[model samples]
Target: MKTYFRLLSFAKPIEKFAIPYVILTLLAVVFNTLQLALLAPLLTTLFASGSANATILTKPAGWADVTGYLNYFSQQISFTYGPFGALKFVCGVIVIAVILGNVFRYFAQRIMEDFRIHTLLNLRKSVFNNVMDQHVGYFSNQRKGDIIAKIASDVGAVQFSVTGTLQVVFKEPLQLTAYVFMLFSISFKLTIFALLVIPISAFVISKIVKRLKEQATMAQHMFGLMISYLDEALSGIKIIKSFNATEAIKDKFDSENVRYSDLGRKMARRQQLSGPVSESLSVAMVTTIVLYGGSLILNHQSDLTGPEFVTYIALFSRIMQPAKALTNSFSGIHTGLAAGERVLELIDQKPEITDAPDAVSITSFNHSIRLENLSFSYPGRTVLKDINLTIPKGKTIALVGPSGGGKSTLMDLIPRFTEVESGRVTIDGTDVRKLKMESLWSLIGVVNQESMLFNDTIFNNIAFGLPDATQEQVEHAARIANAHDFILQTEHGYQSNIGDRGMKLSGGQKQRICIARAVLKNPPIMMLDEATSALDTESEKLVQEALNNLMKNRTSLVIAHRLSTIQSADMIVVLEDGQINEQGTHLELLQRNGLYKRLIDMQTFND
Candidate 1:
């Protein structure tokens, strides 16, 4: 119930839809019950067969005796205008009642449909926005497919279930109550005996669907895993094909697919069973009522006339429909609640990294960025230890290291992408944590080896976040990164689509596009992580020249495995085994003949 209400809160100002729906539904129920209530009077008039001397009924005292009022008024019409006239009158009333009932029902459904859509819009938007606000590190520890499922599939299930059940909760019980009241008016004894089906259906259906919630939870989880497998396979299709592991990937995905299918079958079987059980109970109650009510009529022990008795049976049978709906909705609620739990779990997650209460937005970078006593760990392994480094403004500092040497981790700290474990990173003199993330990020630019580009036009990709960038500005940035010539050579020039992740471009072209994006941002600080290591000599030379243009008079941190790339850096910091192995100007480090020299020598020998 707690989870259910939390999901519902997304449908705020619910009264805007609820109050009107309630009024319309009430009117619909009243007229719908009238359509059936008039049955007894219509049947009574038909049996009279135009007899002017038909027995006149006493005027009913109050509305509570609804059948009495109907019978009295209908017989009065027969006496005044003959049976044919009453037939016309009763039939006309029934038609009007049906039309009004149907009209109210249609409008009521419209309101509920609007409510459902409103809730869905708010719920999905909230889920997506919250997911986007999470820190970058949060994604590293979670599966992309699992998050996708929660936002897409689970949220979809939650909206239908929560809103559908709410509809049933308000409308079904009131409908059932109206049916019961009419039955009692026709014959009190028969109504009591017939009402037993409600409890019976509830008890039997409860037992059948007792495990539905648990199965539904497992099914949602399995579906997420299957989606995860599918995502991994699609993203790594190249690797799978290269290694001849296509069949292996297919088998892994299929295994989870089969489990999800089997569980779905089980859940469907259980859900389908509830309907039949409730229907059978309804039939049994009707049969029992006929036997009991017939005995009362034949023995002359009841006030139910022949038409009234027939109407009593009609009303009793329909009562079960709402009861059946209630049971089916209960089954659906189990599944909905299961999905709701997962979605709420996501919404409830607080981002691990957030700005402090006194955080200020710093719009400029000056002096230097300093890391003091900075140590970090991931679970059981340490990634960086006591890493102290200072990067002064307008100076290019390069970090040269082997793999897993904390180069990337140290770079991430400047932007506060990852929280420090033991120490702090300060910009100028203020702690990075004291600065708003957006303000800090606005002053730094990053280009990684992967060259992350979206599937959009080159102009849009270059101006990704800067939506208002002009064409001239983009061209200038592209020229500086050596991307303008090739961009214009494409079929559409600057407007050409880059395909997925810029796959339409070559290695050098893609890197140049990424560099152009950094150049457009034109931040005071630049962080390039192995920007040229993946390129050929010709492409590397072009990218290196662009990098030099990008880093001119800017505070820069460059991480490179190619010794030739960072030799001209103002200072070179060597990191190994999560510690700074050495630090000096590139030429000074070469004079020491230490780790930096050994790396340079090894690269030269390989060349």
Candidate 2:
């Protein structure tokens, strides 16, 4: 119940829809019941064809006297205008009741439909916004497919289930109350006997649904795993095919698929079973009422006339309509609330890296980014320890070392992508943690090992965050990255659509585009993480030149897998095993004949 209410909070200001819906629904129910209640008058008045002594009388004063008044007026109408007149009067009343009843019902549905759509909109937006705000480390700890599933499939299920429960909770009970009231007004004793149907349906449904929430949680989780598998297969289609793991991938996915399907089948059986069980109980209740009410009328022991007994049976039988709806929607509501728990769990997660309350926004970069007594770790592993370094303005600092030496980890600390365990990183003497993330990141440009591009036009990709960038500015940035010529050669020039992750471009071309994106941003600090590592010799030269152009007159932190790319760097920092082993000019380092010399010598021999 708590989970369900939390989900409903997304549908704020719900009274806008609720108040109008209640008013119309009440009218619909009243007239609809009248449709059944009028059956008695229709039969008793029109069917008595030869009652020539019928006379007119006063109308019914209140609900308690409606049964007697109806009978009295039926005889009165028969005598006043003839049997034909009473037939016309009763038939006309039933027709008008049907029209007015449906009119109110239609408007009520319109209001409820708006509420459903509005609730879905708010819930989906909240889920997606929270997902986007998570820290970079959060993605590594979770599956991409599961995140996608929560935002897409789970939110969709919530829309149907949670909002549907709203209608059932509000409208159904009022409808049931109206039905019960009319049944009792007809015969208090028989209504009491028929009330057994309520508890029977409630108990049976309770037992059937006892474990539905647990099963639903399992199903949602399994579905996420299946989607994760699908995402992996699609993203790594090239690798899967190259390794000849087609059959292997198929088996892995199909195994989960079969499991999800089987669980779905089981859930369906339980969900499908509720309807029949409740309906059968309703039928049994009606049968009991008939046998019991019939005996009373037959033995002259009850006040209900033949026509009144028929009306009572009609009203009592359909009492199950709302009860059946309440039971059946429970199956869906249970599934939705389970999905809601998962979604809320994600939204409630607080990012470990956040600026202090007094954080100020830095509009420009000046001086150097300094690491003072900095140290960091992961679970059970130290990545960087006692690291102190400085990246001065307008100077290129290259990081070169053997793999697993913490070069990338050091780079991540500059922008506070990962928090430090000890010491501080200060930008111009103000701690980075005390600066708003947007302000710090705005001054830093990053081009990673993998070229990340959206499926969009080259112009848009280059000007991604700078949405208002002019065409001339984007082309100038592209030219600086040596990409203007290649971009124009494409089918649509700057406006040409680059397929997913720039798959339409070669490795060199893609790197140049990434550089162009950085150049357009024109940040004062640049971090190039092996930006040329994945390219061939020819492509590497093109991308290396683009990197040189992007780093001009900027503070640069370069991590290169290929040692030759950083020989001209102003200072070379050699990291080994989470600590800085050496720092010097490339020539000075080679003269030291230390780790830097050995690394350069080995790379020189390979070249």
Best by TM-score: 1
Worst 10 residues of 1 by lDDT: 47-56
Per-residue lDDT for 1-607 in model 2, tens only? 8888888888888899989999998999888878887888887775467555533446666767666666677668777887788888888988999999999999999998898889889988888888777778778899999988898888888888888888888778888988888888788888888886579878998788777888898999999999999999998999999999999999999999999999998998898888888888889888989999999999998988777888999988888998889888887888999999998887788877777899999998778889999999999999898999988889999998999999998999889888889999999999999999999999999999999999999999999979999999999999999999999999999999999989999989999999999999999999999999999999898889989999999999999999889988999999999999999998899889999899878988988
Model 1 lDDT per residue over 471-568, tens place:
99999999999999999999999999989888899989999999999999999999999999899999999999999999998999999978898888
RMSD of 2: 1.7
TM-score per candidate, in order? 0.98, 0.97
Q: How many pairs collide in each candidate, listed in order?
A: 0, 1
**Clashes in candidate 1: how many?**
0
The residue pairs found clashing in candidate 2 are 55-76
